[model samples]
Target chain A: MRNSIITILKKELKRVFLDRKLAFAVFIMPGLTIAIIYSLMGGMIEKLDDDAHEHITVVQTINMPHDFRLAAEALYGTGMIIEENEPTEKDKAVQKVISGDSDVLLVFDENFIGDNREGLPGVTRYANSIKDFSIRGGYMADSVLESMRKNILSERLGGVDEATVFTINREDVAKTEEKAGKAISMLLPMLLTVFLFAGAMQVGMDTIAGEKERGTIATMLLTPVKRSHIAIGKMLSLAIVSLASCLSSLAGVLISLPFSNTMFGGGFNFSDLAYGVSDFLLLIVQMVAMALSFVSIICLISALAKNIKEAGGYIAPAYMVILVMSMSTMFMQPEGVWSYMLPIYGNILSIKNILMFKYTHTSGLISLASTILFASVLAWLMVRAFYSERIMKSS
Target chain B: MIEVKNISKTFKLSKKQRTLDGTKNKFKIAVENITFKAKPGEIYGLLGPNGAGKTTVLRCIATLIKPDKGSIIVDGSSVLEDSREVRSKLCLLTNELKVDPNFTAEYLFGFFGRLYGMNDSEILKRKKILFEEFGIDEFADVKTSDMSSGMKQKLSIAISLVHDPKVIIFDEPTNGLDVITARAVTDYLKKLRGEGKTVIISTHIMTVAEKLCDRIGLIIEGGIAAEGTLNELLEKTGAADLDDAFFSIYKKTRENVS
Candidate 1:
């Protein structure tokens, strides 16, 4: 039986890899698509990072008191530059914020010093309509006001050498850096899912559907081998091809990493985010399970289709489902109970968690088990379909 | 040897929606009470028109489909009980010859040989002999995509015989071949008969049937209309040729039924 299966697999692989067109479809195009996707994503991330660090010209109106101006100068050091403009009214400051002439405008009210005494600093920051930068500006303004209040309290305490009354020692939390690194880490799993899905469809659909279209399936069926053997062999061949494509895509992503710092404008490297031995092993298991799931699903679909055209039709909805599941990881962190129970959902979520250095054993195990279960059921369905009269008589 | 006894098959056709509203499906009998026998070293011809159940009967013998109501025993193994063994003992060459366009003739030939349980050396030996005999050695390494229809047909025939089974079945093998290729195929079938292999061929061409088949069975609709040796059928129908005899049997059966 092993020999028979191996023979079938050899023939299947030969039929796929030996043809120039299929070879290109199965190997080259998928890797190229992966490179293109990661390249685009890396470009977007770089653009965002560049926007975060770009020089910002902050114009302060004359109503801004000496204390607020001093705080603004201190806060804008290195990260952002605040260029004080000539005296301007409130409406002029708002116009500068909207017209992109300045990153922000610090407007102080006429009774600013009196308001500080009354415990309402009354400061307004004007910035462009961009959300992230605007939020960052708001946080900066709040910090400056808090510092000024602490200084006023020190002066009111009679200057008896107040022991650093508002000693705010801000430690480097590293969360933002970790978040960016985690984004880079998620690249593999996302690419893995896409590549495996595409590879399975490319190889499996072409294996069965192409044969049916070309009228070669009936000839293979007429051989002395059992239909079940043929089905298993073909599915196994597709699984191997999918695994190869996945590996190729991973290689493509890894190869593009050195250029990522330039592409993403931050010092992010995939090698820097590498996991330990145990974690790496778990990832391998996840990938194997993912490849099996993908291959089995595509094999089942291919069996139902009569030809490549019909197979192409069937795979469109499959692609949509996978695409939605993969993109969901980007917008939402995998947390809810339902997220752990779904098959591909769990797989992508686990990868997200792993990338963020939050490892959960239960989630990984459940995802792997679900993938295996789904693969078993689909493989069984595909085997049964090989015995079906429609497949046998389709030619 | 091959034995088929009282094999019947039925196909259900859903009723047309208009006049047959709410009606259940009706069955069309494709093969009914068909019985035949072929011993070693004989050629049995199943002669029928387009939908006269010849291919269906052959399919049952090949174990590609099951008979609704009968058994086929090939080389002492029942098709239902030991289909794998029956498959091993026979080769069914259908008219639809589709080879993987990516593989060379040599690759396909060797692949099928391995599937038949032949070892590498044995496959290599048979590959050379078959390639030489069939004049396929020149295109041995050429991809099947570039081969002509006649060449593909020949390659298919060679691939079918790689394991050298005791019984061979052909369903309209010469349907699309040119005259020269068709003659070559017929001569090859005769050659298989000479080697003491039981050959069953299904065809509507009277000349090929009359020249090649030792015994002929005329199938009409879903059952055998007549069966005998060529001379026997000619005498029974009082016809000058096999074609005339075939029409005579068909007309008599139609008239009797109507």
Candidate 2:
């Protein structure tokens, strides 16, 4: 039995490895294509941010107070040199802002520091909101003026404690780790499930359905090997091959993390994505189990189909169903222990927990057990299909 | 020896199949009460028209499909109870069986050889002889898809015979081949018979049956109408040749059914 299974696996692997086109599609394209796409996206985002910075212009009124002027200069840094322009008339500065030349116009009343706080003159600000850079510059100028107001109030009130009125200080459990965990937990699980299914479908649909369509299955069935051996052999080889294929896509996701992060505004540093070796090993276990479950389901469908075209038609709906199921990880929070009993959902949740460094060994084990149990049942169904002449020789 | 005893097969026609077959009945009888035997050192030919249950009988004997009733035994092994043992003793070739198009003839030979538990040396020895005999060695490494249909047929024959089973079943062995290739295949069947192997084949080609079969069975409408040596069938039908003998028997069966 072992020898027969090995022979079948070897033949399947040879079929994939020897066919250069199939190899490229299954093993190389997923990673390489994603990397290129994400890198382009990253470059576009960086360019947008740079363009926003370069086009910003801040304008100040001539009678701007010395303290406020010093604070503005400190805040703008080298930006003040390139962007600051003295306007001979207040109307001209307003006009410049309206014309899109200047991003913001700041006007101050010459109150000369009157102690009547209620009647004190206020600063008037104007900017074009249609231009994004103008809105950003206006916000910056607003923040600086608000700080000056707070300083004046503090001085008048004999430097009263700000905490007595209102204050907020964040206390998170390891902020950097929390940020990385949240980002990866949400994104990686969804992408992992998608890639795993995509990989399995690429090869699993062709495993038996293609053989039946091309009439090669009769030759295989005529062999002396047991039907169970054939089923297990096919599932074993498909799972391993698909795991490798999914890993290629995972490599794509990992290698392009920085770029994808910038695109999605995750802003995660590459080092923040670090997972320990043991954590990765656990991930591999989940990957293998997930691949097995996917291949078994796909193989059952493929065997039940009359031909490759029919198999393909059957598989598209399965893919859509799985994709929708996996998408649950994005919006739906993982439920109680019952979530670990679900098939694909369990695997996704387990992966999410692992990425966030929040998984317990008990939960991981339950997820693996559930996936394998489901795979075993599906594989048994596939074997039954192999022995069903009505299904096998339908055409 | 091969024995098929009253084996009948009925297929439940799916809606699409019913439409294609143009039948309102849900069941189609592919073969009924089909029985035949082929002894060692003799060639048995099943002669029938298209869709006349010839391939169905062979497929049952090959264990590709099960009989709805009765049983088949190949070399003392029941096809139903001991299918694996029967499989090891026989080889089946049909139009419905094929190699992966991307695989070369050599690769398939090795693959099936290993499945049949042939070690590397045994596989190589058999491969060399079959490839040389079939003229497969010249392009043994070329993909099956790249080969001509005749070449692919020849390769299929070689792969089927990799384990050199004692009983060989072929359905329409020369259905769509060039004259030369068909002759080669017919010659190979004779050689197998000469070596005292049991060879059962189905063909509608009168000349092929006349020239190759030591005994013939005329099948029509899922049942055998006549079975005997060519001379005996000719004598029974009071016809001049095997072709006339077949048509006469077919007419007699149709009249009886009516």
Candidate 3:
């Protein structure tokens, strides 16, 4: 049995890898292309950030309050250029912002600063939301006005310090770690699962359905080997291929990290990622299980189809369903053991837990065991399809 | 020796196939109660037109499919009970046996040879002979996609013969080949018969049947309309040749059915 499977695996891998064009298209190009594209996107983001600082235009700031002036000066210390323009009519100031010539238009009321204020002091900010720089400038102006309001409130409250009302200290290491972990969990599992499925679908359809379409499957089936051996051999090869492709895609995502960090203003330090070897080993194990399950799904669908086109039609819906399932994890509450019993959903939750460093041994084992069971069932169905005369002859 | 007894097969036609057939009947009787025998050292030909159940019978004999209500025995092994044993004893070829576009002939030959449990040296030995016999040695290393159709056909024939099975079966062996390549295949069939291997083929080519088959079976409408040697069929139908003999048998069978 082992010999038969090895023989079949050798043949399939040879056909896939020896063809230079197919090897490049399926295995190499996806990762390399994605890495290059994301890197370029990161570069564009960095350029936009640099250009945003020069775009702070503050109109009609001659009567700005003392507290607002102090806040605006602090912004200048941080390298923001808050240019005070000539006092213009309200309509013209708004028009300049609308035309993208300026980032913000601030109009203060005539009784803006007074000893006895009758009406509530008001400031109107006109900024185009469609422009990122204008939006940033608008947010900065709002912060300055908020600081002035806080100062007025302190004076009204008999010299109580404004900062004493609410002191937000976010220097706790555990809390910060949890926040980072939550963010990573919300996004990475969905991305990883989608990438693994995409990688599997790219090659798995051709493994069986393509052979059936070309009539070469008959040649393989006529051999004296058992049908189960053929199914196992094909599924194993597909899993390995898909896992490698997913890793390549992951490498693409990782290679673009530094640029993305600078672009998004996260300033995450790569050296601060304190995951140990065991953590990665666990992640690798989960990824392999996830990949096997995905490959089994693709192979079963491919086996049921009469040709590659039919397999493609079947695969599109499966991809959409898996994508939706993976996306559901972003909002899914960490439920009890029952949630780990679902198929794709369970695998995804397990991956999320592992990445966030919040997985329990019981939940992890159940999820992994469930995934392996599901994969085994799918593999069995594929073997049954292999033995079916109707499926083989229709091809 | 190959013995097929009361072999019958029925296919449930899909909606599309039924529409093409212009009938509401959901079943198509491909082969019904068809039986024949082929002895060693003889070339037996099944002569029939398209959709005459010839390929179905061949598939049944090769154990690629089982009959609906019958049994087949090849080399004293039951096809239903011991298909694996049957597969080891015979090789089946049809136009549907396509070459993988990526691999070369040499690669496929070695691959199938190993599956049949032959070691590297034995596979190389058989490959050398078969390639030489089919005149495929010159282009054996070329990828199948780059080869011409005739060359691919030759390569397929060589690959099928790689295991040196005792029985060989083919459906429409020369359907799409140039005369030269077709002749090479027919010549190899004769050689296999000379080496005391039982060979069965299905074709509608009268000249091929009359020239090559020691015995011929005329199949019509999923049944064997007549079975005998060329001279016996010719005499029984009082026709000039096998073509006229086939027409006479076809007309008699159709009239009786109606």
Candidate 4:
């Protein structure tokens, strides 16, 4: 039995690794494509950010007093192109804001400086709400008018302190590193589960179902090798291959991690996650177990199918099932030890625990054990399938 | 020596299979109460037309599938009770089973040899002998996917013989081969028989059974219609050749196609 497993494992490995085209397609292509696309996207996003920062908002004002215009010109001159000495028609100035030519338009009454008439002077501010530039320009114009009012009140009332009302102070107390770790914990579990299964699916279907379709599996069965050994050997090799494929794609993402902030339009670093070596080791185990569980499920399904196409037909639904199970982890908190003892979801929860610094060795090991046990059961069923004549039925 | 005693097999037909076969019965009896023995140093052939259960009998002996009743013994090991032992002593080759297209003949030869529990030096020696015997040495490096159909067939035959088993089984050995490749296979079977191996085959071809098989069993509708030497069959049917004798018996014992 040992010899049979070794023989089958060697042959399977050689089938993939010795063929240059197959090796490249399965191992390197996924990572390379992700890296290339991420770089291209990141570069374009950074350019747009730089362009938006350098823009100057055009503020157009009408029917303003000379003193008030001078005060506004002194205040926002750096980022605003103030045009108080230009055209003063309210409709004409408002048209500029509507056409996207000017960012903001402010119009006041003809005798706005005389404060003893009825009450405060009336002013109308117009800017396109959809455009960030116009919205920002309008806010700047409001602040300028408020400052003039404050200065006038301070001189008449004999104190700037009385005109300013009670002052308020703002404070933020969020932990940056903890928040970053929480984000990783929530997303990494779901993504890791999806990727491990996807990698296994990409090759698992072809390994068993394709061989059955071509009648090559029968050639192996024709030997003296025990049927169970064939099952174990194939499943073990598949898990290793799936892990390799997953890691390849992960490496692609890792290589582009420095640029991911710009690529995804976010500013958080994964390095802020202060996980110890033991936590990383536990995460690695969970990942391997997850890969095993996924490959075993696919192989069990593939064994039931007579051809690769039929295997694919069956596995597409299984993918949805794994997806739903993995996606549930995104919205759920770890419930209990039992919740961490489910199959794929268990592995995901364990990874989540490790990321969020809530992991216990007992729960982590239980999750790993449960995943392995599930995979072993599936492997046993696949062995029974290999022993049966159903596997030999081509049509 | 190989002995198959009173073996019968029935298949449960799926709904679609029942429709295609136009049969109301849920089960189709593939073989029934069949008995045969193949001794060393002789090539025993199961001769029949399509669906006569010739391949089924060969498969039963190879332990690819089980007989619902009865038993098959290869040497001293029962096919059902000691399948691995029987398999270690036997090899089955069919057109449907093939080599991995991604691998070369040499690599697969070593692979199967090791699966049969041979050491590296033993596999090297055996591979050299088989590869040269069947002229597979010329294309040992070529992948089965890239080789011609005839070459692939030749490679499969060479690889099957890597263990050099005591019992040799072939199903339609030359069903889809050129004259030269078919000749090489039949000649190899003859050579194995000369070395005192128990050789059995199933075929619908008249010339193969007439020229290669030492003894022939005529099968019809999943039962043995007649069993004897070529001359004995000719004498029994009062016919000149195997073709006439087969038709004479077929006409007597034929039933529904299924």
- Top DockQ: which candidate number? 4
Clash pairs, candidate 4, are none
Q: Which digits, one per residue and each the tens of the lDDT, describe model 3 over residues A271-377? A: 55566787788788888888899999999999999999999999999899999999889887757898888776787898888767787778878888899999999
Please give the lDDT score for candidate 1.
Answer: 0.80
- Best candidate, lDDT-wise? 2
lDDT of each residue in A119-155, candidate 4, tens digit only: 7787888889988778877888888888778877887
Q: For residues B77-195, could you state the per-residue lDDT of candidate 3 as single tens digits?
A: 99999998888889998889887889989899998898787899989999989999888899988999999998898888888888899999988878898998888888889999999
lDDT of 2 by residue, A121-181 (tens): 7777888978887788888887677766776677777675752377789887666765787
Alpha carbon lDDT of each predicted model: 0.80, 0.85, 0.83, 0.84
How much TM-score does chain B earn in each model? 0.94, 0.97, 0.98, 0.97
- lDDT by residue (B1-258, candidate 2, tens digit) is 999899899989889989998989999988889888899899999999999999888878878789999889899999999999999999998777888898898889999999998999999999989999999999899999899998889998998999999999998998788899988998999999999999999999999899999999999999988999999998998999998999989998999999
TM-score of each: 0.85, 0.88, 0.94, 0.87
Pull out the clashing pairs in model 1.
A46-A264
Winner by TM-score: 3
What residue pairs are clashing in model 3? none
DockQ rank order:
4, 3, 2, 1
Those runs of model 4 whose alpha carbons end farther than 4 Å from true positions after fitting are: A57-179, A263-271, A324-332, A335-338, B255-258
